[model samples]
Target: MKKEILGGLRFFLLMTVLCGGVYTLAVTGVAQLVFPHQANGSLMKEDSKVIGSSLIGQNFTDESYFHGRPSEVSQLSPYASEYKEMITERTQAIQEENGSTSAVPADLVMGSASGIDPHISVAGANYQAKRIADSRNVEIQRINDIIEANKEKDLLTGNEYINVLVVNAALNRLE
Candidate 1:
């Protein structure tokens, strides 16, 4: 009985080390090496200061900068009410005005799970072009051209998405 219990303890310890420590380290190391860019790309450096992450979107309200898709994520309202109430009220208003069913596009309704999605629908990007152009004192044609240039081809079918971070980076490079 004593021998059996000792053997069982040893087996459990060996399995824990193999499955938890060794496996986790091996997989993580390999993943980091295989996707180095993705692992490091989240860090954004600006003027020697880490400004933000490319993985998340910042709230850019200035007309000079392009706007991202509408965010459905809401904070605590000044009024004391349930969080769901706020969302329901806003969603109901939108549905009544737009006549959209509950099947609204993912981008149009709920915020990204990460709350920092850097990609926007092509339509959302285009919608902000005019405002951006006007704010930058640039020609609308020029802005339209930029949007067209950055437009992504349909990957599988008709779904096209623009990486906002990439486009904004390119825009900064423009003279």
Candidate 2:
């Protein structure tokens, strides 16, 4: 009986070390080495020292800067005591105005889970082109040409997408 109990304890200890220690180190170490860009704390340093992931969306409302996709994340007015109630009231009002029972698109209605998405839909990007061009005193046609140039072509169907971060970076290059 004593020998059996000791054997069982040793087996449990061996399994724990092998599964917990070795497996975790191998997986995490390999992942960090293989994908250095996604390694801890690398993404935050890629953009301006704003301390946000460029992969996420941010709210940009100024007419001079291009706006990102609409954010669904809402904060209660400081005057309101209950933030959830405030959100409910505002959503109800929007629903009544739209006269639709369908929920808004997840991307359109609610902010991306990361709250820092930098991309916008083609339509959303186009909508802001006029405002950005007007603010910069650049020709709208030139802005349109830039947009067209940045579009990513699809391999099979030749579909194109304009990455917002890349476009904004290009805008910064414009004199």
Candidate 3:
């Protein structure tokens, strides 16, 4: 019985070292070697200063900048009254901000699945173009062009998305 107990102890130690230490190191090393940019949090930089990560959303309430989707750290249930009320409020706010009577895009009113998604649907970006243009005192065409340039297509769905941070950065660069 003592010998059996010793054997089990050895097995446990071996697995703890192999799985906890060695496996973790191997995966991290592979990630660093193969995808260094992503492994490093996909940070965006400006003038050698870290601005933000491309993988995370930022809250921009300034009228001069385009806004991202509503961020909810914990998503409310779709059937909940709070969720319905929040959606209604967001839709009204977007309409008022953009001076649009058109229906607001779903992305504008809904929180993203991750709640930290940096990208918004292309339509969502365009919906705010007028406000951004007015605030920046630039032509609407310029804002649209910037949106066009930064738009990315999803691999599976082929739907276009624009990173709000990138678009806002481009807006800042406008002379």
Candidate 4:
């Protein structure tokens, strides 16, 4: 019984150190070397100030900026229909601000599963292109060009996606 107890204790300690310490360090080291930007939360900067990250979303309610989907961190929970209504009303208000006849894209009114997805669908970006252009006093064609330039194609399906934060950053640079 003594020998069995000792053996079990040794195995548990060995596995804990090996799995919790060595393996974690090894994987983290490899990730740091291979994908330093992504491994470090894909943070984005402006004027050397860390404005946000490429992996998370934030509210963009101003008329001049292209908005991401409504964040779940609102007074009404994301699952509630009232929350969706709020998103719809906001999008429509922006559309009205720009006098855009085009309908609002679905993604703009719906939050991503993570509630803070940086990427918006291609359709979502284009839907706001006119509004952004009008508010910025830039040509619509130029806005479309910026959208196309920022699109990221899916590896498996080849569908286009846009990173909202990056695109907004690029737009800020246009000024």
Going through the candidates in the order shown, the clash numbers are 0, 6, 0, 0
Q: Which is the winner by TM-score between candidate 1 and candidate 4? A: 4
- Candidate 1, run of 10 with poorest lDDT: 97-106
Q: How accurate locally is residue 54 in candidate 2, as Cα lDDT from 0 to 100?
A: 56
Q: Model 2: per-residue lDDT, tens digit, 1-175? A: 9999999999999999999999988888998989866666335433455444556655655556665654554564546767546555555643443344444322334444455666655544565577688888999887787778786765886555566666775676776
- Writing each residue's lDDT as its tens digit, candidate 3 over 98-147 gives 99989999998998878888889999999999998998898999999999
Global local distance difference test of model 3: 0.91
Write down the lDDT of every candidate, Cα atoms only: 0.66, 0.62, 0.91, 0.84
Those runs of model 3 whose alpha carbons end farther than 4 Å from true positions after fitting are 73-82
- Runs of candidate 2 exceeding 4 Å displacement: 1-16, 40-51, 73-117, 153-159
- TM-score per candidate: 0.64, 0.56, 0.88, 0.80
Top model number, lDDT:
3
* Candidate 1: stretches off by over 4 Å: 41-51, 73-115
Query: Worst lDDT window (10 residues) for model 3?
Result: 69-78
Q: How large is the C-alpha RMSD of every model relative to the true structure?
A: 6.9, 8.0, 2.0, 3.4
Clashing pairs in 4: none
Which wins on lDDT, candidate 1 or candidate 3? 3
